[model samples]
Target chain A: MNIEEMTSMERVLATLCHEEPDRVPFFLLLTTQGADVFNVSIKEYFSKPEMVAEAQIKMQQKYGHDCYYPFYYASLELEAWGSESVFYPDAPPNAGRPVIKEFEDILSLETPDVFESPGLQKVLKTTEIMKKHSGEDIPIISVVMSPFSLASMQMGFENYLDLIYDDLDRFKELMRINESFCVQWANAQIEAGATAICYFDPVSSSTIIPPELYRKTGFRVAKRTISNINGPTATHMASGRCLPIVDDIAETGTAVICTSVLEDLSEIKTACKGKLSVLGNLNGIEMRHWSPQQTEDKVKEAISKAAEGGGYILSDNHGEIPYTVPQEVLTDISRSVKKWGQYQG
Target chain B: MEFEDTLLSLNRVAAKNIISSEFTGDNAFEVINEIISPTLERIGELWAHGEIALSQEYMASRICEELVETILPADAPSRKNMPVIGITTLRDEHMLGKRILSSFLKANGFNLFDYGDMGPESIVQKVKDDGIEVLMVSTLMLNLAHEVKKLRSSFDNEKIDTKIIVGGAPFLFDRNLWKEVGADSMAVDATESVEKIHEVLGDAR
Candidate 1:
């Protein structure tokens, strides 16, 4: 494979297809951090789709990462359900208070049109803008929250868990409602020009739930949602451990699985061998303090473990990189990937 | 009714029945300290080991909280002389850790002021105004966990002697994070929080 001639989109696509790209593709997953790059507050960054698009392009160009996305934050999805978000000067916005204050509220819940919801509209518009600017060179990875994960934000996390154990039927009913919105929103992003859909579902992580509960709930929901998505899909657990359910995640039909830092990269690669492509395990929490040399060492290690097989994408373990991580470290990561991610004949 | 099994399975009715039939006002504290606390600890262990789902641990804690509230006498004199403790989610809204710890502390007859969610400045101000001796801060994200360092500095500037205890995913992920964030101690779960408070407040309490 002549790696230098490959575009970022081709590089990522080649990897997803289990073929050697020019080099191992790397994604920064710079979501809220784009605000910092754009020199705007997080609140202001999400307000304008143009700003988000421009920031994403700038970030990819600056870091030389293979992919960029239009995700602002997970809570942005909750806005469609009438939940307000609390923005910060530094961090990503969090869902203010749960919309469903009581169990009965789920009955009256209506799935809002994705095109009509302001937050969802902004994401779709951002995707369209990125598509227009980047064209087919760079891949635009759009994100959609899995129904089970979004349930925690819809109601309180504890309340959602309570609903699961307290009234399994009601919880399933809630998941049904959330699944509709997820499908609509995911398809809308695809129509807007997303290269692939990243199904963000942290709740299904073995760290959060046992595999049995996941098979009964999140697994079913994800399989159905991914089947309905218009584009290829990657299952992301937002840095939650997925080794116990790696097989189940592969069974969900996603093209790739974004693993967690909590698990060993070599083990993850071995588990994902032929079932799915792997995209992560870098410790985002520790990335903030890594020296340039340390960052390079980490990158080299990840490539050595997973990149040789030709089905890996280097990225921070958590879906989104923290805004606190220094620019120098990110640059080092991209440089190191280019240096050591080459495939030998 | 098997109290531990009832809480584990999340059978609230069975749990309530056990409390009504087996628990009396006199044995309330003993029941909480002996039966309820240990059962929740086992559940926490199961959760930490990935043996049970988080929902089971959370619902178990919730059920235990309800049972504790029902059995414990509200006007118990032991609640008055305990340290003035305050808990809050520092700049992050993920409340499972805070809620669980708050309930666990309250069940132990500690006077706790649940500050729901607040920024660093508000938290500092509240800590000073409430004269909280031991402040427990819970944050689910790493950046928010970093807020504890800023909070610690604020407390220092104000010359407040409140000892800070942090518990959350970040602290658990990074074992030394508590000390790095200037917290006096870090508790892995609610059960450990009680012991940490005792250790943090030593002779001063």
Candidate 2:
């Protein structure tokens, strides 16, 4: 199968399940650049449905990337919980300051309804538009927060850690609620015709939390949620140290694992052992920060090492950072993927 | 109490806020001044016993900086009579402490200018442009302390009468190196920073 001949469904499922694809399918955390390149600001994109749809279309047509991500994860969802968030026309929301002043506040916290909150509702709405526009054309993977990451946003990471041991019951209650919202969000996307769901679990990475705590908290809810979902679910471990807990994460029943720059691809492929497809370990920050040639070299190196055992989706080690990863680097990365990522039977 | 408990207490103190009854942004530092310094000393004790993770200590330091943002006032009456102070980290770009010290001085009525992540020449330029009377440089990494010596030389050459205050994880770990950086004052935590700055600058009043 080649790019034009294969349907979006075939391309996604083939690559995610560790099988040969017509060609390598490319994806990105295209929220920031998609907005920039397409001329739709984040607030406008989120608040208005038509703007988001137009922007998604423009990013694909203009930039020629394979997939579209409705980027509402990091600060937006947390803002719905009472933290002050500053929004710029071009950039996604940034955490203004922590809202929960004391540990007691965590006990009283309530998870905002996904359908009700403006920020989250924007994501759902964007997914609806993308699903409609893509219309079985290309894969649309909607991103959402994992339980641990949501908790970190509610309170700062330190207070969140204390809650795990200091108040396990309340912690469990919060996770259950957040997980419920996540399932609802993912299911809504599936209904909207989304092919896959990407769960970005940055704060919960093993680098931040010990693997035991990660298993107890982040992995538990994640596994349950991924299992409940119908479409293929990809979990992003936003730190390199998560390699140790690969087995634990794989047990969550996710179809794919996208990791940060820290994990060496050689080690992760051996460890994953065909249990789950591995998507990344691209150096987004380095590539964004380094020269185009350097970017090409790193992408080629990453693709060479990771693309061997079938299930590999090439993207940055992380998502695109704002004002970083110059246009040339993005082009170089795309070129390298085409040059080196050919399937050898 | 356990060592972890003591560290948490310090974090709480450093991170405390006296959210004013009135809407105006000005806040009194009297409450934090009473508790934060002592709390930090106990945290230093906890770290000595290896009770807190290195990350936790770094976080505590960061939280102290965050707490300072709330404590400080945004609007200033004047910099004409007030002592002008500068704060930054060199080589290592950890803005947490620099932000904290900047906010702290702002709260206590200093004309504080932030020359963010600068080498010696840039720091000298900022000092000159801001008419800086006091300079504070921080190094989060141990190896970056050498930048402070370069900063001192630049200041002397520029004929600037600015008091250089050096502090960070590396300098705090070694007293001689802390002094060797040629700073007039230094402190390990945000609370101690208050006393250290006062001793070197002789009452910003």
On DockQ, the candidate that comes out on top is: 1
True contacts kept of each: 0.53, 0.00
List the RMSD of every prediction in angstroms: 2.7, 11.0
Stretches of model 2 off by over 4 angstroms after superposition: A1-4, A38-42, B1-205
C-alpha RMSD over true interface residues, model 2: 9.7
Give one digit per residue, the lDDT tens place, for model 2 in B91-199. 3444445654554455444567777777686778888888777788876544356678888888888788788888765564345566766777777655466677777
> What local distance difference test score does each model get?
0.85, 0.65
Query: Per-residue CA lDDT of candidate 2, range A186-233, in tens?
Result: 776777667788877765566555566677778888888888777878
Clash totals for all candidate models: 1, 2
- Evaluated at residue A223, the lDDT of candidate 1 is 91
lDDT of 1 by residue, A187-294 (tens): 999999999999999999987777888999899999988888888999999878899999999998898999887788899889998889999979887887889899
Q: Tens-digit lDDT track for model 1 on B104-194?
A: 6766667788998887788888887888999999998777898998899998999999999999887876688898999999998777887
Q: Alpha carbon lDDT of residue B88, candidate 1?
A: 86
Among these predictions, the greatest TM-score belongs to 1
User: What docking grade does candidate 2 earn?
Assistant: incorrect
